[model samples]
Target: MQKILLFTLILFGIDSIFAVTHFLQYVYSGSSGIPNLPEFMTVGLVDGEPFTYYDSNIRREVPRQEWVTKAVDDDYWDRNTQVSMDTEPVFKNNREIAKQCFNQTGGIHTVQWMYGCEWEDETGATGALHQFGYDGSDFIALDFKTMTYVAPVMQAFPTKQKWDSDRARMDYLKSYFTQECIEWLKKYVSYGKSTLERTVHPEVSLLQKDPSSPVTCHATGFFPKGIVVTWQKDGVDIHSDVWVGETLPNGDGTFQIASKLTVKPQDWKTNSYSCVVQHKSLQDDIAVLLEEKNIKRTNQGGVSWGIIVGFVAAALALVAVVTGVVLWRRSRTGYGKAGTSDTDSENSSQQQPKA
Candidate 1:
C-alpha cells in the first residue's frame, strides 16, 4: 500500500511527501478567443509554489519570489526572457496546429504543454514529464520507457510521427530532462532553501455548518505541504462517512487540508469522537474532540470571526492555485479522446524515446 501510494504521488507530480521530493514544473498555456486573459502564458513552479511567471501580456520572464530576485543575476533573467520569447511563437503555432487537427475553426480553444523534472532528495532518484494537451485534453506524451511518443488521440498521430522521426530531438529531450533539468532544480532548491526547507506547524479547526452537518477538521497555515487528517471513533480510525479535501495553498505560502466526518448527535454524545491530525513538524498528533464547545458553528451566535476568515482564506487560496495552473483540461467538454491515455501520472522510466 505504501509503494502504491508512493507510485500514485510520483505519477501526479504532487509534492505532498514533506521535503523528500521536490518538483520543477513549467506549464505553458496558449489560448484563442479568451478575452481579458493572456493569449500565451507560462508559469514555473517549484514544489507547487510558483517562483517565476511569463505571459504574452508581460512579454518578459519575471521573478515571483523575493528569493528568486535575489539569488539569480540579471543574465539569468535575460536568458530566460529570451528563451521564453523564442518559445512563445512555437506555442502559438502549436495551438493553431492543435486546433486544426481537432477540426476547430473558431470559438474558444486551448493548447497546454506541461513539462518538468522531479528530484528525490533522499534517494538521489529523478523523473521527468513532457506532455501536450489540445483543448485541455491529453493529446500526446513522451513515454520514457518505450522511448516513444504516445498519442492519446487520432489527431495527434501526425505529431507523434513527426516527433518520432526526429531521433536527435528525442535524445536532446532525454539529456536535457535528466541532466540539465536536475542541475537547475538543485540550484533553485539551494537558492530558496531558507524558504522552501522551513517547516511550519498547521493550525487546526473543527467546524460545523448546522446541527446535522458533518464536522470538518481543517488544518491551515502549514508548510512543506504534507499532512494527514483522520476521523477517530472511540479511538479507532473511521474511513466511511468521511470526505477528505485536497491539500491547498495559503496566501502566506503555507498549506491547508480538511476532512469531514458524518455522525449523529446521539452517537457523538455517547462515544468519544475526535479529529486527528498528523504532520511531520508535530511531536504528537493533534486530536480535537468532537464536541459542541470545541466546534465553530456557523449557525450559532457569538461565532469566532477568525474561523470564518480562515475559511474564506482557504477559498481564495484554492482560486490562486487554480489560476496559477489554469486547469483548463478538466473544464473542457465534448473533446473526443483518441488513443488510450495513460492514467498514470509520471512515466517512470528514464530512457530516451526510441525511433
Candidate 2:
C-alpha cells in the first residue's frame, strides 16, 4: 500500500505540490497626499502564471496589462530614476525581470520584490525603496534609510577588486532610487488603505466528498481575504473526522474553501448538520443549514467548480491518504499511536497526497 501510494504521488507529480514552488511579489506604493502620486499598486507572480496586479484606488485585482497600459498611457514620466535612464526603460526592465525570475526560480522557496516610494509628511522627507529578495531574506535593498544599496546575498567591496562587478550597477540604482525616484514619489504618488476595506460576501454551499465520504461546506467569493468556515453538528462543534482544506484564492479578487466533516449515518439520515460561514463583510455569522435540497444542489454543481476548486479536491484526497492509511493500519493491527488522528495538522508536506 505504501509503495502504491508513493508511486501515485510521484506519477502525477502530486499536482498540488509540483506547482507553486516559489512565491514572487512586486509592490509599488507611495505615501498618501502627494500632488499626483499613484496609488499603492502591487503585482505578484506565482509559478510564472499570469501576473495579478492590484491598485489601491480600485478594490479588486486586475491583469498585469492594466498596469502596463497605465504605465504606457500616462507616460509615467512622473516616476524618477536616479540614473539617466527614463521611466519607460525601467518599467520595461521590471516587467521582463519578473517574467525571467518566475521562469528561473521554478524550485525555489520564495521571492519578494518591491519598486515603490516611501515618504514622511511631518518630517518632510522622502525616498525611493526599490528592491527584491529571495525567500524571506533580503537579498537586495535600495532604500533611503541608509542612503545606500546593499544586496545581503552579495559581499561589498573591501579590497576594491570587485569595483567593476554588478555592484557598479547597484550603486547607480541606489543613486536613482534615493534621489530621482524619491522626487517622483514625493511629487506624483500617494498611498491609501482602500484595499483593506474592499469586501465581497461569500456564496456558500455543501457538497459530499464522495458518495460515501464526509460532506464539505464550501464557501466562495468572499473578498479582502482571511475567511474561515467550520462545521457543526447538533448545535455543537465536532472536530473528529474533519478536514479543513486550505483557503485558496479565486484568481479574482475573492477567495474560497472547503471544510469537510464526517457525517455518520444517523446525522446524514436525520438532517442535523450545519455549516457556519464567517467573514468581516457579514454582520453576523451566516449559518447554512444542510438539508436534502442543499446536498442535491451540490450534486448538480458537480465537476463544474472542479476547475476552480481542484486544489480543494486534491486537499481532500491528501487528508484521506495521510489519515486513512494510518487508521487502516492501526485498525488492522489493533494498535494506535498517540496523537495519530491529528496527523493532518502535523503533516506540512508541500506535496498533496494522491487519494
Clashes of each: 7, 7
TM-score each candidate.
Answer: 0.78, 0.42
lDDT of 1 by residue, 112-147 (tens): 666777788888877776776666567777776566
Colliding residue pairs in candidate 1: 11-345, 11-346, 147-353, 147-354, 152-339, 153-338, 153-339
RMSD of each: 6.4, 17.5
What TM-score does candidate 1 reach? 0.78
C-alpha local distance difference test of each model: 0.67, 0.41
Give the lowest summed-lDDT range of ten residues in model 2.
334-343
lDDT of 2 by residue, 202-310 (tens): 8887776455666778888776445667677777876788887655555554567778777765666686778887776788888888775676334455534565555
How far is 248's C-alpha from truth in model 1 (Å)?
Answer: 1.9
**Model 1 worst lDDT run, 10 consecutive residues:** 334-343
Clashes of 1: 7
